[model samples]
Target: MALTDAPVAAKSAKRLRRQPLWIIYGFVFPAMAMALVFDYYPALSGLYLSMTNTMEVGIQSQFVGFSNYVQLFTSSIFLNSLWHMLVLAVVGMTIGTVVPLLVAEMIFHLMNGRWRYVYRLTFLIKMLVPGMVVVEVWGYILSVGGLLDKICHFLGLPGGSTGWLVDQHTALPAIMFIGFPWVAGVGILIYYAGLVAIDPEILDAAAVDGSGGLHRVLNVDVPLVLGQVKLIVILSAIGGFQGYFAQFLLTQGGPGWSTMVPGYYMYQSAFVNGDMGLASAVGVFLFVLIFSITLMNMKYLRSSQDYAGQR
Candidate 1:
């Protein structure tokens, strides 16, 4: 009986070995197909289009070969808009990354219960609020006759009655402030989840060793949550590069284009100016920038452990 079972066991083991390969292909194929359809094809098409002079109304195109990219550098408006995007990326990343992590860390120290629930719910609600609604709400709040202006006037600040979003000097920063809370609220939730996953014993040990409050957080909690911080930073950077909706709704990239971002520029190129070729170039540039940043982030932040080790 044992000798007969040996052959059956061998066959079963062979099938098991084959099963995983089939499963791997099965799982990978759908994702690969989706990427080819939605991501890769569009990207390749855009690269091809960038070398041509394509207009919205025309079905015909003339291959111009690098002229669109060359023209980008020569156009002062395009160059200035690109520069503005860089600045916005830096500023947005700073506010979105730093503030959320700090808030998460503070929230973590609070005894987990109703307070945590309430705070988390509040942030989630803020996230659910529409971007346009938030922008318009803040627009009213920052207007010349808005609540902030009245408060500033009461405090006797300079330009107390001024419209913050209409002033070129403050417009970009004001728009940034409006957009930031939405992004930061999401980041806070991510970090909060990360904090919850941390081993409680480690924190307890730190407290027992007389490391309390900020010292304990800076030394122990922060290091342990470095992975989460890295995630927040990379995601925030990506969001910064892609940010435009609030600025579009609120200032319309106005106050002398101070709030202009790459996304807005791409939109204008594609629709308003009807320069599909230039828009494709801008799309390609954004794709490359985002891809490079993501690669750099993964290289620096991702751990070296294999699947078994992580488990």
Candidate 2:
């Protein structure tokens, strides 16, 4: 009887230990359900919609089976828009990732904690400003006789006579320069936090070994905070890939499609041309491209870390 009772008691304790896990899973289930309903369901719907022709007036959406995608790839305007998006994404990714990391390094090296806090707070405040407001402000800055143009005029430069946003040569470049310096609040803050979390003893040891500032940053700092770098790169890629709001507001995909991007073209297809199927196809393409690159990036990072034995 005592032997049987001992086994029963052990089983009871094991079951008790699992109760909290069950409760945790119960707590998480609802949020997962909501995400599936609101986020993933729409994505799946869009995927389905991409394969069908949803353009018929007062009729059921007919199954088109990849025809929309064929139309998209064949269209010069669509391909051009994709090229523009690719350029913007590449340029934005580089600038956005590098500038914030460099700024964060600067802030981290500040001996005065108060100044670091002040700078961080300032960037955070900038983040709170509405996106539309930022765009409008930049529009004014790029407009003729506005701040940039006036500065250019003071320097006696051409192309300042017209709004930079209206010039075929400068329009895309103007869109690219919207957030000058690109010290995005989230990027700076996240990188700064990652840097701050690094063990100061390691940095001190590096310094003791006669490592200069750049050397320390390259060998010690960057490796330690590479996870943060990866995070920022992925985020910047996503943002730049879908970035068309500035074009929508400032350029309207003009001066003559110079600023056209896939996102803007998708808007044109859906709203301007009433071609929901093509728009859905574009959405699917962007999603796939982003997802594939993100996966590849993560895989590369993981393999590199493994090879270098990063902690």
Candidate 3:
């Protein structure tokens, strides 16, 4: 009887331990349900809609079965837009990632904490302003006889008559340069946090060994913060690929299609042309591209072990 009772008590204790886990699942279920309803449902619906010829609402649409994709692949405009997006993603990621890192390093090395906070708040305040407002303001600044033209005139340069946003040559560059002197608030904060997490004793040791300035940064500081750098790189790539608001608000794909990107192409297909099926196909392409690259990044570019191995 004692042996049987001991086994029963052990089983009871194990069941009791699982009760908290069940409660946690109960607490999390509603939020999970909401995400499925709002986010995942729309994505799945888009993929389904991509298979049909959904020209407009309240109209009978037929199943096309990959015709839209075939048309898109053969379209020169779509290929050009894709090339523009690739260029924007690479250039934007490089400048956005590097500039903020340098700024964060400058701020972190400041002797006065108060000044550091002040500079941080200054950059952060720009992010608080509406993105549309920023784009509109830049539109004005890049237009004919705007800020750049005025500066060019002051410096005795020609081409003041030409608009930056209107010229095929300058339109893309103008869009990419909107956030000039890049020092993005979020990027700076992330890099600063990475710098802060480094062991101070290691820095002190480097200093004692005569490591200074660029040497310390390149060798010790950068290696220690490679995890954050990798995270920023991956996120920047994703954002740059999906981002089209600046192009939409500023160029509207431009005097020509010089500033066109994949995101804006999708937007124009759906809203301007009212071709929902093609738009859905574009969305699917974007989803697959972003998802595939993200998975590859996670699998191959893991910063923790990669940087540790660098040592």
Local distance difference test, each candidate = 0.77, 0.85, 0.85
By TM-score, rank the candidates, best first: 3, 2, 1
TM-score of 2: 0.86
Give the runs in model 1 whose Cα sits over 4 Å from its true position: 1-35, 160-162, 179-184, 303-311
Instruction: Report RMSD for candidate 2.
Output: 7.7
If both were scored by TM-score, which would come out higher, candidate 1 or candidate 3? 3
Models, CA RMSD each: 7.6, 7.7, 7.9
- lDDT, residue 135, model 3: 86
RMSD value for candidate 3? 7.9
Q: Per-residue lDDT for 1-311 in model 2, tens only? A: 11112345555666554467878889999999999999999899899889988874566888999999999999988899888898898898888788988999998999799999999898889888999999999999999888998887778876467789988888888888898978866889878878887788988899899985788888988888787787778888999898789987899899988888999999988888888899999999999999997898778767756855644
TM-score, predicted candidate 3 vs. hidden true structure: 0.88
Give the best candidate by TM-score: 3
Winning candidate number (lDDT): 2
Q: Per-residue alpha-carbon lDDT of model 3 for 49-140, expressed as tens digits? A: 88889989889999999998988889888899999899898998898778888888888889688998998889999899998998899889
Between candidates 1 and 3, the one scoring higher on lDDT is: 3
lDDT by residue (tens digit), candidate 1, 8-116 = 5555666554466878899899999999999899889999998889987557889999999998768776777777788877877778767887788777778868888
